[model samples]
Target: MTQASESHNGLPTEIPSCALLQLLANSLVLSQTAPYLSCYDVLNLAATARPFRFLVYHTPNVFRRLELGNVKTAQFDIDAIDRGGETWRNVQLDENLTEDDFYSGPLRGIFSNLRRMDILRDVQVLSLDGLSVTAELVHDILVDPAYSVRILSIRGVKNLNERKLRGALQYACRSSRPRGTPRLKGLYVFGPRDTVPALAAAHEGSGSSSPTSPATVATAWNNRSQKALSDALAEEPEAWYVRRGSQFPHRISSEWASTLVACSGIVSFDSVLCTGPRHFNSPAWGTVNTEALDAAASSTAPSVPHFSVATHSLGGCASCGAAPEGWTVWGEEVVASRRESDGRRTSESCMTDLARFPLLAPPPMHSASLRVAMCPAGQTVRSRLPFIPTVKQQKARFIPRCFDCIRDRYCGGCHRWWCESCYIGPRASSPGGYAASSTGPDSVSSPFPNTSAASDDNAGLVSKIRDGVCADGKCSLGQR
Candidate 1:
């Protein structure tokens, strides 16, 4: 649309709207608006005008985040490519490939599509999650001066070798670039088999009172890696990797542990793996002996051995007295030997929820001496107890669970379990010390010295909790 106005010579002068749009496009207004626009929205807007198209292609903010690995987008591309007689699987070609070779590969169309959309240049956050991208492609992207990419996510990139990925990251970190140019400050590499043993060990040793935080775990693991970033954590603390799987898999290799530790800068990594009740249904819960599980559940003495050497130094469970932090309630004792004549007791128990816990060394079918029932919660009103009773309380007696079973909403002082709702409710009961508030306002004073406001302060509360106390302010357990 054009607007006409009278000129000094009485001739009509035409005014162009594109000139106004162009000015605004190059201004701070466009920068502000670009972040809120999706990749599609920006492309659509650019298509509407030549000036917009040029500005959108050149502007860094317009494509700061390029999510090439989005599930829906990937699916759409796959369908579209299939219709065009193209394959979707990655190319398994000879090593030391080039960009020209990539153009003829399975990922050829994707790169072409990226070029068509002008995506890669100046992209700060690029997510190539679940793509079978080669290490060369990833390294090229990281090293490219055109890209301002600060974070690169390569989760589920199966073909990416650890050594090649390491070299690429090391090169990018040490590469001499212009001032104010961003280096790879954040990297996420989550493959199916990747696991960290240091974190698992730390988690096993950590307890209700002295929990191993993610930051602490990262720092400890980073120390082991021996490669420190100049200002990695200070700039981007959230730089990390996440496995969409179990906290502790049954079989973990030493190589995988070393790889996790060896990951260097911009790779400033942390792991937040999945945990909780639903994890029981996973394939990790395969072996179980019904009769042994039943027997162990009803056994008078349910003693479990400590597996980790580190956990031994941390002492045992407060309730069970001898069971260590990561103690196993399934599988035979470490001392037992197995024979083929002793067939696995393939019972209905293996298919049940009770078989959720990770198996110890011995095959569950071979021994009935080690299996124990899973902890189940009970109703609060009927129980009328400070500590929440297990479901077994309705039929039989209460059984003390391993630290892993009763993780959250549990008292570290006495290892007593509490319902999730009650722990976070308005009472705001502290996990430390004997929770007098849960019993009622008329409850007796805490076992520690003073019950005054000053004594209930942060320092006093910590001391009282550390010293140890349970429901009735009478737990006789000593400090760790």
Candidate 2:
């Protein structure tokens, strides 16, 4: 029923009980504001009232990208808070505590709200990174005929692999997508393979425990948290656990040719080259770096060159332009005569060959060293070395052909890599003497000084270095 109120002018005004919601849900107002709100913000707003819940849930724009990474953290916080710090610490310290012993505990409130909302209706991009999502939830999202998600990121999702993704991929390939709309491009399964060195150093400096010490406890937490909310809805099938095989299950090996045959919908496989965090700018994951992938996803393109950022090792020779297999750098005396007895290349042999090449990989800001010259392309280079110490000290993160870059020269002083042109060009001979020596000048006379590793701006630091200006605005090369 409408109620009448007296205005300041003594006029009778009709005000409805739902007047507030009516004004807020006006098309003009919603259109102006809805785009800016995040998934959490929308969910939080919806919880305020019943009408708001219906409005937020019905809006397709609100669910374009679903980032539920924080949900996992929320679950952890509730569990830790519910159990006192002493109890939680005891659980962490328990040596005999198996992963099976841990459970998600009571965290069905926010998660229950999440499941009730129809956030998946028009979702184009879905990120479940680090979430303990159930196989049922994953299957329903992927295999369902109603929901259509273009790009699904499942990095760090426990117990998920090719076996679980098979039905989704099959459905994506066979299903018909509307014109101009995105088709299921790829399912990302890559994440940070190892902890950042800076983080490890920070922990050590802070007198924190070893990173590996909490791994068992973390595993147990992840297992118990898997579908803690979904379990309330329905029990998962036993086959879901059986198919995973091991506690640490292997995803579809992108290295295998059979993987492509199995998952036909996936335009590109980047599980091997994912060396950094998945959310931010990583050249390894084409969706974050390249628009060419989006175009490829819509059209029928058998091969996507832009998708292969880590295709070649160091490219061809700078002079004759010979291929990597036959071409060898001039001063590469390390593996000059190295030969494979079986005439077949393995990962081990590839890493051996990579040792001879002068290369540099971009480091994530969190892990960047003050000693090294930074590259704008920010991501950790994944390198596993048991043999070569020279390259190890350089903090080379990736193996040969792991990342795509063409640098013919490496400087140990500035800890930077350069191409022949950049090494010999006028810019190299500029004020900073950036190219003065392959091994930069002595610290006392060197123009290119190391910047602080604490600086968050990589682009600014790299720009300043390339311009050949010292931090003090003086030219070390004795020229302006």
Candidate 3:
């Protein structure tokens, strides 16, 4: 066996030649074995020996998918909260290091080390789900010239707003050299809704026609918040900002759609959801701003191909367009009833003429309280100073029903319309009892138990007259 094949510790001391090892590694490709090796698996193989390490490090084609954080099948050692921040700085900078070696390190370190190792340069699919990503990190990875990243998924990352997202995309598209090269093809960003306005502001600032100033952007955001608040107040006086539930994790705002339209080279955008305070009749997702997208597509150079934007929620309820079955807007009332012997006002005695309705109530002479009425238009109309309204303008106020539950009680606290089932309590016996009843022409059953009463009033307007029973079996709207 000679010195070359000499045995040491009951093992041959001679190692396989680099060429032979390379050939063996090459043979481990998809045609012979599995199509791909995980980032972890590749790193493990690399740790075996110097020859194997060299083969794994140089052979970038072997790794097509790189999942960083905890996925369905795999759980990374990196902390979800710390996001490998503390661990990354201490990681040893050795030549044999792979991304899996930095599993305990930050995403930034992994990306940087990948660039240093030249491993992920050919990586096709990169999933950063269940990870904490910064704007700068996102920009660096997406715009890195060394990376030919085709599919990028950043779902479940907190605080990643539309502006940062759009910036990364724009940077990626711009960084693609000589044009016509495949930039990022697929992007999945299911981030929080609060990040949307910043993206919208950025897009507005970069507008070709009229650029919005920072002050304008601030004003616009404030206005949007104020509008939301006003709408909430109209539903109920004690309303505040409350998150609405949806099938998807992230809330898709109008600004999000605009951001998607503005960005280029994104083939498929997934996991978009509609922002709530969503009506029962609201579509799972809002319509994509196709007009803006079309306009964007038209403005872009013909060389840039338009990719399809996808969302989980898109269509809305058909009943959403129609007004509630019975709604009226009437003025305030001034009740004057004498106590009865039975301690209950008789039906005949309680009945009052419609003309006697307080079109203009007598203002309290001494009281300092200012009564502010929320108009149907979601604006506050003060009644301190009395003003005569024309007969034509004296219309009955219509209260819209909860689109989902068809219940009349709208929660001002959450700014969401809820039926007795949602706002009050859970149903006792049957789930079907809580569901919204279909009002099809041929359907025999009516949502309201007193259908005859509803029909008697002017065009179903009397439906509002019926008392609303809450989940607790108490009449929330009071007895008729």
Candidate 4:
């Protein structure tokens, strides 16, 4: 009777914080398999009664990523303290959002919070194809010393201009970043190869140094902080690496390796054409930048990409173009682009062949110089070289025709080939079907088919493949 009276009175507080926490724990366990009880659904339970609400309010740490939708309204903008995250955050506004709603309202509020914490941040990965982020706002982020944004993806952002984009990038590393610890490491600016440079130029938060002495502009791009990336996992499986081309392993060749080697950490290396593959939204370059030659090669590939007269080598109309350390400007650039339109015949071209890329490719005109973007999170200053070395004229003169290009004319070992080289593997046989060395794993199969040097001891087996005979089943020399 006394217990019933106490229950009816419902004194000051009915339950303790421990009881609330216990409820949360129970809900989490129930949510494991029940499709109806989502993690968010568990949070909603807090609104059910006072005990449940106490648990949700006290333990906020359980939420790492906070997202809301049409029905919900919320956000998170705190200092990056200890946790590797960006402080100047940006999220979509609470109302009706269109394509142009990127830089204002909700995003601005988020960035303001980031500024409070002084950490440069980035969206995990996003394309800039139709975004309306203006160059001015991006410039503001670049110029700030505390700026720490890396890898800005403006895939299809067309509103950006070249000069402004350049300014934004130069602003990133223009001076030292906040150093006691790293908030933001490197920046990556990606998009459909050609369309992105302009945006990168304008929205380039991967700042540059001061424009004082002429020589200051002469800096080489190389990636830093490799130890951190290496220790990330003993050896990053091929899955961890991504090239500009295909899905899985990010297919890339030697031509794109220099840029890859320059980026410090384990990065998803994007492939862009130095002198070709200009179309960004075409069906051909749908998911990646895969060229024909890369698709054919199998087994272990060349450590680096080989160039060709028709492919890699590029000579610029360099009043606006970039080659290595020593290259001269040949002419000015003119960039005119024609997007996919209403039944209009499309036109595009390569970076070198005047016929393909006449007038700085596509030809309307953007800021052009004889330098490539310096750091993945950086940009290059404009400078002229005392001399210009052409790619086609390089010593190797490597060409890529096919995976099985073992023809004598294209074989580097054939002595007659200069333009291109045939494919060979360390595995078993070379083009002439000879082992690179008899001691390696790929050495000719034992019993020595046609191996005259040892014929005196093993005459019968040695004659099997030596005289273009396949006496024994599965002999490569005989197949050759």
- Candidate 1: the clashing residue pairs are 185-266, 292-368
- Against the reference, the lDDT scores of all candidates come to 0.39, 0.36, 0.39, 0.30
TM-score of 4: 0.27
Better of 2 and 3 by lDDT: 3
Positional deviation of 355 in candidate 1, in angstroms?
Answer: 38
Q: Candidates 2 and 4: which is better by TM-score?
A: 2
| Residue-level lDDT tens digits of model 4 in 413-440 | 1112111111112222333333334565
Q: Clashes in model 2: which pairs?
A: 381-397, 382-397, 382-398, 383-397
Predicted candidate 3 versus true structure: per-residue lDDT over 1-480, tens digit per residue: 445443453222333455445354553452123124456666777798765665555543555567665432233444433333344346545555543344423665566767777776766667676665656656656556677766566766644555766765655555454564435555656432212122233234445544368886777677667766665555421111112222244444444544444443333354221122222112311222222212222122132122212222111221232222222223333345666998987433222222111111111111112121112233224433333566654433323221222323322222223322112212211223322235642222222332242332112211221233332333333211
Quote the positional error of residue 264 for candidate 1 in Å. Answer: 4.0
In Å, residue 143's CA in model 2 sits off its true spot by 1.2
RMSD after Cα superposition, model 3: 28.2
Error of 4 at 66 (Å): 5.2
Give the Cα error of residue 110 in candidate 1, in Å.
3.9
Question: Could you tell me the lDDT of residue 329 within candidate 3?
Answer: 28
Alpha-carbon RMSD to native, per candidate? 25.5, 22.5, 28.2, 25.0
In candidate 4, position 305 carries an lDDT of 27
Q: State the local distance difference test value for candidate 4.
A: 0.30
| Native-referenced Cα lDDT, model 3 | 0.39
**Each model's TM-score, in the order given?**
0.36, 0.35, 0.37, 0.27
